[model samples]
Target: MFQRSISYTALLVGLFDASAAVADLTADRVWAQTIDMIEEAGGSITALATRDGDNLNISNVRFTFDIPDTDETVIVSMDGWSLLEKGGKVHVEQPDYQEIVVKVAGQDDVTARLGYSVRGDMGVYSEVEDTLIQTWDIARAEVKLIELIAPDYDPAEATVEFVLSMNDAISNMMYMGNGHQQSVQSLGEMAFDMTIVTPAEDIDLSASARMRGLMNEGFQTVNFKGTPDEILAELTAGGGLRANSALDGMEFKMEGNVEGEVFNVSFAADKASSNVNIDNGNASVSADINDIAFNAFVPAEIPLPLSGGIEKIAYDIDIPLAAAPEVQQVHIGMEYLGLGISDTIWAMFDPTGQLDRAPIDLIVDLSAGVRLDRDLIDPNIEELMEQDPTQFGSIESLGLNELLVSALGAVAIGSGDFTFDMNDLQTFDGIPRPEGEASIVVSGLNSVFDQLIEAGLLQPDQLMPIRMGLGMGFVATGEDELTSEVEVRSNGGVYVNGQRMR
Candidate 1:
């Protein structure tokens, strides 16, 4: 019995070893697929990808891309690449590059000593489908753009450092028989810092963008209906682009500065974001900045600290991508939510200290629903754009939802819902004529003028002329309220505030 048990144990050990070997061999097949993908992406890769024990090592890897119909070519070479499988997960890493070269036909080759390193984790098998999934975290990546064979870089010369990183990034790839579907999600940041120096000027710029709460809500389909090269050609010819993928939410920001001997200017923003629902052909984007600022330092000839900015600035845009005339709507709004000046700078212009120091508020909101001739989200967009840019996007009708502006303790709001006469474009001098009535309501106009005069910013003589103009164009609707009505008749006559203006 003891001898029989020993034999059985040996058999089990042999079976386990055979299974492990098969898993090791699978790496080579996967690497072949990766190479195919690179080739599909317009690059040629040459390397010996092999598995060593439980790890795969690709040695002396070289990748190259040539610009079509041009002598420009980009080449990237690396010494070592590695991928290891453990605990049902694959980990990937690559050594620093030996060199990177960009060659143009008639210009001196631009080259750099490239450095790259990556560490990522990927599941061996998919949990959702019979596909592959990868979750990667970029440890560190930097490209030092410098001249080739330059022993040392000059501090004053132009130099750029581009850095990218990710905290948690996940990607899913589903391989159909002839095509593939993919989705990517990440939360991280990217930064680009550059310095340029010359005999005439010196400039330094640093920009950083962060992305969080990001998710590609749907899988993007890459149809391989024909050969790889054929597909690539079609895409390059602007024949195959489509909107098959949708993103849930994303935010971005870019801030930098320019400095020189004569002037220095700094500008920055904190927020730019998008929320997309492409399935329903609905999307909204908002670019907002709180505490965004701009400041300039220049020659003393200006005699003032030239600095001013909006404390809050925002623009919101909404669109229906695939809807037609009756259902299509496009909305956009811009607002200087808060406007302000520094006390030191304000004091330069208002030496009497009579002006209000508090920041002012301004808001402008507008939206319009329009009828369209075709779907805006059609996949074959290149053909449409090439035929006639304006003719393809003809507008049939316009329904103004709201037009609002509030500032300096006063408000003005108006709306115009009208149909456009496309055939009579020449009547309105190239723009389609509108048949509608628009009305604007203004409040606190007198009070606003009084405040400006009290602050010494407006003289009484100037205020009187403005008031008289308002009296001619607007009617008093209520206490401290003014109403202005504008009408565009079907016969092309125009009226303003119950008076014939045209």
Candidate 2:
């Protein structure tokens, strides 16, 4: 996840002891240095403008960049800037930053207007050599979701084109707040390389699609349309995650398979990989994407799980498709529902995240003869039948029909593969048609339940309905312990369905 934040504290640190220690920090100077660095790195940083008074008004710092190796030329523009002191507090007023913008020489580009304000004072007393550190942590927050609509494209011929909305989208960001460990920081001068063409060579929708299958709702919209070949994009992207920060300027290949939409094509990372170094060595995933799949890999792995709500919960296992039943391209889905990172702002920062939050939708594709021993889940149903035929009449005597619906709300997606499909319907019963087995891989249930109990969020007595509700069948397979499974068949017990959102 890319993070973004603004810094007023660090910029003002020297000003705090001001009067004599701090000198005039000119916006133009900072702008000049920033631009010079961008150019020296073989980039085009132009349109530099600056002004000084009570407010250092530096506006219109627009530049187009073509990074080394890749072909995507990511456009970087800072249209407005103002540094002012009000009531003794230095503020970056008129700091209307565009978060992201999808750029094309003469096409549609999404410019995301951003709201930025920081509380602190910033002053550059002397021309310090290392004034700008290797990286800077801007800020961090608990909630930030990027919503996008794909660009329009030609339907006839498949072409690859994309507008990353790099204009308004905030990159190279660093943020901080209540739930972080280290101060947020973003690295700098990163570039990616890639090629863009019509009729994208290939893409692996299996993973993304499988995740999407669970949700009947279409997945998030990310459309790209342009015939940008060997696109050269050089821009900085960073943000805060409690204390963690990153800055990367990359150049990657891109192509618009569809006229207005950047569809299935190929991409790759190049050149700059040599100079890239993450401050937090703990970063787990990094890679190159090219023709064969939606995402290409360099040599990055998933981050290791940490502790607390920050624990990174994952079941990274592959499935043995050969052992599984014969099936054509399997439209895979998730097992969990309403999955999300924990409400804690520090969750993503914890080395071992506590199944922080669950994903809304997850997708996958499977070929025949492929038995997946995946660190995934199985879409399933849990049925509870009456032990005796007469029990129904007795139970109904209690006027418990209302309780029936309540039982339906018990089972839910616990995370991972289970969350992919289980998020819908809240509760479920064997509709006339069953979606087959509830294949899933689960962990942390006991811990999560324990946490609930400790927080007085749940009661032991309440466990029965939940267990019975989620149990594939009420029949006990073990003497004392209740068991779970990946299959569901029509049995004597009732099946529950969709649960209403609270």
Candidate 3:
């Protein structure tokens, strides 16, 4: 199900890419520029022609690209394509099919086909904003490939299909000032169903993605006062480009049969979203997979009686675009909530049922706050990609916040706030000099060990080293609980529980 949803995203991106490549052309002039635009994007048409009246026909339109240093060429083709100017709207459809073929050297070609169509409002321009807005509606975007043949794989018994329906999803695009700036936004819902048939199994998947709110303001409006490069320069100077996309109430599911056995999977999230904003010579990104319930089922023989899932998973990060000489702070956070397995699985691990299995859960709450010079990460991305790393950056301060975990009848929590000096590396033997301390507290530690001993998983003699290590590294803070205070001095000396280890 997730795979299908990802594919849907890719398809939408492809549609946008194709539309943006030719957005500057007016509806009245699209007929003459259609072929030219395709070629400009490195695609070729086997043949092109215009029908009498108000329609255009294109035959065997294809785009071919050769893999670098490889004997493979990927060809994407459309058959019996037509574009019509009707009632002030441009209607484009390829009723026959769209095909993709990969021809590999010394191998048979692989191919797939889909039924596709598109419709858009033409010459939608707004004088108030001095922007040319084009709106496209995808009423039918279906691909039902019965079988795709591959050289090393058998296609006689395999088939795949994709059925997508969008009733009111209107994609709005705006181009300003001779294509100097452009923006796009879309609303409405897309319904999709996909099927995959293989020799061993047949899988069916479905999903629905709907827009949650009105389109963003700046995403649909672009400034045209400057040239293309000039506009880009201005945006970069101010804060680089920014783009945001959001979806709410998204749902997906999948069911399949493997060798006559049945299985199912599904997930739902209150909201799934991503945002990228580049400003102040920095780029900040945040993504949320909120309130997610992932469940799976197998044949009764599998011995799983309940649905297991992740309640939520999310992450956020901030990064600098250019190097800064001063200490720049960056933040990162990741969290896992409500992670658990079935009680039946737990019972297997604790047959005696005296190990507090019900409380046997897993959670990771962690975040990083660090300060460092931008020069460490500052490098032209293009140039950095072409070589290997040499020198590394220095950290001024680090903060480990919200380090919490609860599992196996035990809970541990800790946080670290520390600072470092990069100039003095000898004290730490080539590492930065450090000055600060962090504390960790673990409850139910002794009780957990007692349970292990009671369960015969550990012997009394086995705890000798464990006890010695704990006595040396941690101090008893309470009954069945231990505490550790780790401190690093400016001289690079390290201590735990007030006892110097190094």
State each model's CA lDDT, in order.
0.57, 0.30, 0.58
* lDDT at position 348, candidate 2: 38
lDDT of 3: 0.58
Total backbone collisions for each predicted model: 2, 178, 0
What TM-score does candidate 3 get on C-alpha atoms? Answer: 0.73
| Each prediction's RMSD to truth | 10.1, 24.3, 7.2
Which consecutive 10 residues in model 3 have the weakest lDDT in total? 1-10
Which segments of candidate 2 are over 4 A away from where they belong? 1-21, 40-42, 48-52, 85-91, 95-101, 104-502
Q: Write the per-residue lDDT of candidate 2 for residues 1-502, one digit (tens) a residue.
A: 2223334244335423544333344545555556666775667765635446666665666668664565556565556556553443234554323443334332444333332332222222222222332122222211111232336534343333222111212222111111111222232222222233334434312111110001000111111111211110100112111122222322333333233333332322222111112211111222221111123222223232212211111111212211122321222211212223323333434333433244332223221222222111111111212233322111100101111000111222221121112223333542222233332333334555655565556789987788666554332333232333333223312232222111
lDDT per residue (tens digit) for residues 1-502 in model 1: 0111222123234223433322222455557767888898898989887778878898877788887877777777767567776655455655544344443332445555544434444334221223344444343345555454333445445555554454444444445333544444443443444444433234555444444433332333345657655554433343332222222223333333344335455665444433433334455666555556666665534655566666666777777654354646677777775677677686775676655455666555656655555555455667887887774455656655666666656777777767778788776789898888878898877777777777788999897788888888899999889998888888778899767877
lDDT of 2 at 116: 30
